[model samples]
Target: MTNELTDRGQERRDSILDAALTVFVRDGYHATKLTDISREAGCSVGTLYTYFENREELLAAVLQKVQAEIGNASDEPLEEDFNRISYADALRASNRAYLVGYRANAKVMALLEQAAHLDEQIYDHRVARIRRYIDRNRRVIEQLSERGEIYPIDDPFMFTTALSVMISRLAYYTWVEGFFDDSDETLERVAKTIDDIWFRSLGLKTD
Candidate 1:
């Protein structure tokens, strides 16, 4: 539906999406209305309807935008050779990227948690995102095992799933719930702790 928009139309659509996200984060998802988003976007309710079918669709789009922003913050170059990097360095980089991204999107992440419980679509989307991360980590674990870089696990997929969930919960606690301070020093310490756990779990020697 959005594919046919001209550049200006696309911009308007994006603005509406941004407004929707802002409102969602400020007010809980069920409490937010299209009128609220329209006011936030400086557009009319009719204009919002032109860009989105309904509040649910707008919320889904906002979720997608948040996920895309997080992905951009955390994604590494495809061509980079993970095998050549020290395990500790690789783990440090990954943990730092994830925590930084989570911190940047802390409010939205909290909103997502709320929406996931109230909306089936949001819940499915969140589950799918986690599955994708687990699959990616599992593949990496398999590759590293093949190269004799990490200890052979009895169930790589299960191990990856457990670790991925742990990291995600830790990020949620530290960032979304504000369980700890968000200073750079605190973030570095969190990343190092995650690195140490990853190294020990995978039976990789740390330098």
Candidate 2:
């Protein structure tokens, strides 16, 4: 009985999140109301509030879910075996995984892109998240520097900040701008762009 009830609760939560994604992506953060989300979720406003504290809280939850999905989709390892991976190969793998993930979560990417224009908090949230991800890969940056694959930068943090902005711009364009035709060509172009930018930035020889 307890297990059945728990499953039902999980189902309801997922239903709310699914509905919220549609509403938030279509109407955006500022314009979407709790009542709107409630109706979409097939629940009453009171029930919606029972699960979320407020609109901001609900938006945070939705963003969290989107981030989690993107993270999972981007989880391709840098190597078949971690100890055997070259720095260049790891960088290429990471870039490829990120583009794949962004494509998979294009809707959330679109919503965030739109929301950032109107909300400073949303913009800052994205910047902070990018910083956090870069920080997690500090060892990779350091390794590249030690091998002289990248220029010796005194500050990895500053290097990552600038590099992240460039990479983020490319991902945004590829995922949101519709600049490339929907084909293998587009994917190949994105991957190559990522590789070229990182290679040039790190002072590596490029093809």
Candidate 3:
């Protein structure tokens, strides 16, 4: 009985967060109200309060949820033997993972970007999330460098940071904001274009 109650409670929380993303994505951060989220969530305002104390609290929860989603997806460390995979194959695989993850959570991602600009707390959280991923990618780049698979870099951190932000920002504006024609062919083309740019910067050649 206790287990069932906990499971159901978590489900309800997830639903509320999902609804929050929907409204945040549609209306953006500055304009969204708790009632807007409640209505979108199909729950009463009181129910929303039961889970989140205030607007700030809900926004915090929403940002954390987005981080958790991406954090989980990126938790796996790169293989120890990095050279086993071809450079182009590695680029394609990483690009696909990033693109798919961004697409899956575009709404939350878009909301976070808008909210981060206005909210100091949220800005810190967003920065932390990016830093964590960049640190991990830095290690991977180092391992690849050890094998001479990647070009020498004086600053792995900045290199990874620049590349990550470039692709991620482009993904957000292009796919999340629907700025581009994201039909299957177009998205595939976008991914290919990104892969090529990334390869050229890293001096990786595809056979």
Tell me the TM-score of each prediction against the true structure.
Answer: 0.90, 0.79, 0.78
Deviation in Å, model 1, residue 130 alpha carbon? 1.2
* lDDT per residue as tens, model 2, 147-185: 666678788888777777777777777677776665667
Q: Which is superior by lDDT, 2 or 3?
A: 3
Query: Quick one: ranking by lDDT, best first?
Result: 1, 3, 2
Model 3 residue runs over 4 Å out of place are 1-5, 67-87, 176-179, 205-207
Off by over 4 Å in 2: 1-10, 146-151, 203-207
* True-structure Cα RMSD, model 2: 4.1
All candidates' lDDT scores? 0.81, 0.74, 0.76
Clashes of each: 0, 0, 0
lDDT of 1 by residue, 1-207 (tens): 455999999999989988888888888888999999999999999998897888877888888787776665555632257657664566567667778888888888888888889888889878987897788678767767887989889978889999989988988898888899878887887788787778889988777
lDDT per residue as tens, model 3, 1-207: 123437778888889988887888788898989899999999999988777777767887887877676655544324424447565676577667667677777777877877788888788888987887677667767766886877899988899998878877888888778988767776687789888877788787676
For model 1, what is the C-alpha lDDT against the true structure? 0.81
